[model samples]
Target: MRNMLITGGAGFIGSNFCHYWAEKYPQDKVVVLDLLTYAGHRENIQSLENSTSFAFIQGDIGDQALVEKLFTEHQINCVIHFAAESHVDRSILGPDAFLQTNIMGTHTLLKVAKKFWLDAGVANHHFHHVSTDEVYGSLTEDAPAFTESTPFAPNSPYSASKAASDHLVRAYHHTYGLNVTTSNCSNNYGPYQDSEKLIPLIIQNILQGKALPIYGDGKNIRDWLYVEDHCRAIDLILHKGKIGEVYNVGGENEWRNIDIVNLICAKVDAAVVASPELLVRYPHTPCATSGDAKSLITYVKDRPGHDRRYAIDPGKCHAELGYHPVESFESGIVKTIHWLLHNQRETVNQ
Candidate 1:
């Protein structure tokens, strides 16, 4: 049985991957390493405690000694690197954490993996790095989507750090002969996602009867991948993908930021049984007693270096690994809204 080390396994996509792996590959032992940062919550993967196939450790990936120790003790055969400072706004406010975690932490993992795998004479070992499509920069209205060959032109500090890590992983493969694969995915929205993200933020605002803040004119576009679909694509890449190759995973469903916010407002209002009038604190706000969540939409000043659009061409992943998303934007948004409401209900009940 293989020993898999999943960094940042307590975060949204990473925790979902932990659940998926536990159910699909029960024979393999899973070791999750997370530093319990603000974005990483242990409760996200608490369900794994009942399973003999999973283990969680609280530690930083940048700690070379700890990482090396885990690799040596567990005989780790695969590394799924997901620990990174992911929020764009946070990165803009302070890029140090992004650089430290995404770049230096990745370098640390690569160093340890190369040393342990080579010394153990482990064959067929794989190292998979999770990344974002923002590394390709922005796309215009008529421009084609980002492909594996897209030239790197990262716009934000967060994307730049991820790009650096991606390059390091590629370099390790070429120089050290380490089996490596990378997947640059589009924006993901689903259950267990931090409310700071677009979809969940909108949901939380609607529930609290607060203004649904949208940056700029709210016309910015992004390809929205369901979190579970992303997990499945990563699984396929780990098993079927060729060594030293990069695959782009996308939802193939593009939506403008404004349109998605509007969709969530409508869905949440319809799903929740509470009276809209009672939820609102100020009647002058957009969210009055009209039972319309769209009333809450308020445009604000846009942040610096906000990419106009991001889209990914996943033709290679589909053709090479037969990857196809099971959820469309329409269906996925509905699921996300329901999940937030359900969680909110559970919290209130407790």
Candidate 2:
């Protein structure tokens, strides 16, 4: 492709994809459009400032007139859609924004892209929609991973909205012969990620000697994929996967919530050589108990509509695109902790 448009490229995964695509295809022009909401950060792609092949536009993908204008003015040959309201807790507090940006926003972009593709002809363009495994709904730990054929049973407004957008994308491909491919991926953790999510939240709180809260019994499980690996999988699917097909991207890394927290504590302790910034001990707090960070464990009420488990069956992408995750949970977790350590320190005085 000569020119590509990536919506929400300032957000976590989108920003990673932008860097991935720019470096992979240096000759192509890459434009990033984002609304710069709370989760979208300009600093993520700040390093791209001097790259002539990269450009950033501050705007919402839901704006119809703006989307049409981009299609016409850029002569965009392909689109990688990543914009959406993604946090489950945020969606619970405000469902309207989720519906507007996730479903309606995707619809508007797809419509404009369809018109452009038809005018430009078929063989040279594509619309790659990035989505989440949450769209497959929660599953029991004993249940098999959600495959491409898994039936949708979204439990939260966030996942439901994504499912709605997925359906719209499917309809466009089937009814209009639009070349489309969708990927439903598991949880992603890496640098430049917003701190509101679970991993970063735990890192921030634990580092500050705050309680490491886990909801309910903390048995909820999720397959975690490193952001870089996820971007690699998306790149493969975009260039090689079949049209009108959905692929599942997973790391095969699963851990119980409490286990993850405890592991983080151990790793942080091993990594820290100096006294913590803040550590309160009830004068009588036993040295043995106070020394271990796990003493700060606290359980809260379970989240409303929280999924019990989510795992992805990536056989389709593995067989077709020859994709494989490079990091094991142990290795990935260490790298994540190191990055969090350095990043938290970097942002401390900012």
Candidate 3:
């Protein structure tokens, strides 16, 4: 039975991973450390409180003493580091938090892990760094998807900090022979995601009868991966990936921003038609009777350093670690919309 420490376990993808691990590996103990930042909500993984195999700690990963104490107390043999300031817009607005959390916090975790797992002679130890494909920068429509060999060209402060953390993890592996693996994944959309994200924001706007803001001309492309699929890929990599290797995880489903917005509009519109009571509740929404939700679409100024396109080549993950996203964008987006409609409907009602 392995004791696993998962950092940033209250955020979007991180919380989903925590629930996945708790449900899938009953023999293992899962410890979650989250600072409950703006992106992280305790309610995301609060359900884990019912599970005996799961535990939560409110703290920062940069706290060396706290991190080391948990290491010793739990005898943690596995670490899945997900703590980082991940929003590109937020990073553009203020980069200090990204640097402190992504770079310095990662360094502290690496140092403490190296000391605990190596110096203390802990066995069966593994460190997995979760990352993003934005570190490879944008891709032209004709350009091939980002492979593991792609050089780093992070455009935003968020991606830059993540790139630096990636380098630190690599340095530890090379300099100290720490058993570490990294996975760079594409965009993820699923339940419990922050509404600030593109998909969820569109869904929320559709439900609230607010404008669906599209960035720029809305032609920027992104490869979308379902959060569950990303969680599965991480699980596979943490267990089977080779040490000192980086794997790219993607859904291979690239969609333009406008297209996704339109799709969500269409789905939400159809759902309202089927459940007419939804219209009664959200009477102000365009779909109350005849109007289409797409009418709410409003193009706005794009954020600075917004990448034109991002795609990932997960061929290595599939061939080596047997990883492939199971949810298609169409299916995943539907699930996300349904989840938001149910959960956020309460918000609208309130």
Q: Which candidate achieves the best lDDT against the true structure? A: 3
List, residue by residue over 75-166, the lDDT tens digit for candidate 3: 89889999889999999999999999999999999999999988887757999999999999999999999999999999999999999999
Q: How many pairs collide in each candidate, listed in order?
A: 0, 0, 0
Error of 3 at 348 (Å): 3.9
Per-candidate TM-score against the hidden true structure: 0.94, 0.93, 0.97
Top-scoring candidate (TM-score): 3
- Residue 66 Cα positional deviation in candidate 2, in Å, after optimal superposition: 1.6
Model 1 TM-score is: 0.94
- Error at 89, model 2, angstroms: 0.8
- Model 1: per-residue lDDT, tens digit, 46-154? 9897787788999999999999889878889899988999999999999999999999999999999888886567776989999999999999988999999999999
Worst 10 residues of 1 by lDDT: 277-286
Cand. 3 TM to true fold: 0.97
Inter-residue clash pairs, candidate 2 = none
lDDT of 2 by residue, 1-350 (tens): 46888999999899988887778888888888999999999888888868887888899998999988887778888899999999999999989999999999999988888788865675678899999999989989899999999999999999999999999999999988888999999999887788888888777666666677899999999999998899999889877899999999999898888888888878766665333432231111122234766777899999999999999988888899999999887888889877777766344333
lDDT of 3: 0.91
RMSD (Cα, Å) of model 2: 3.4
Q: Which scores better on lDDT, 1 or 2?
A: 1
User: Which regions of candidate 1 fall more than 4 Å away from where they truly are?
Assistant: 274-290, 345-350
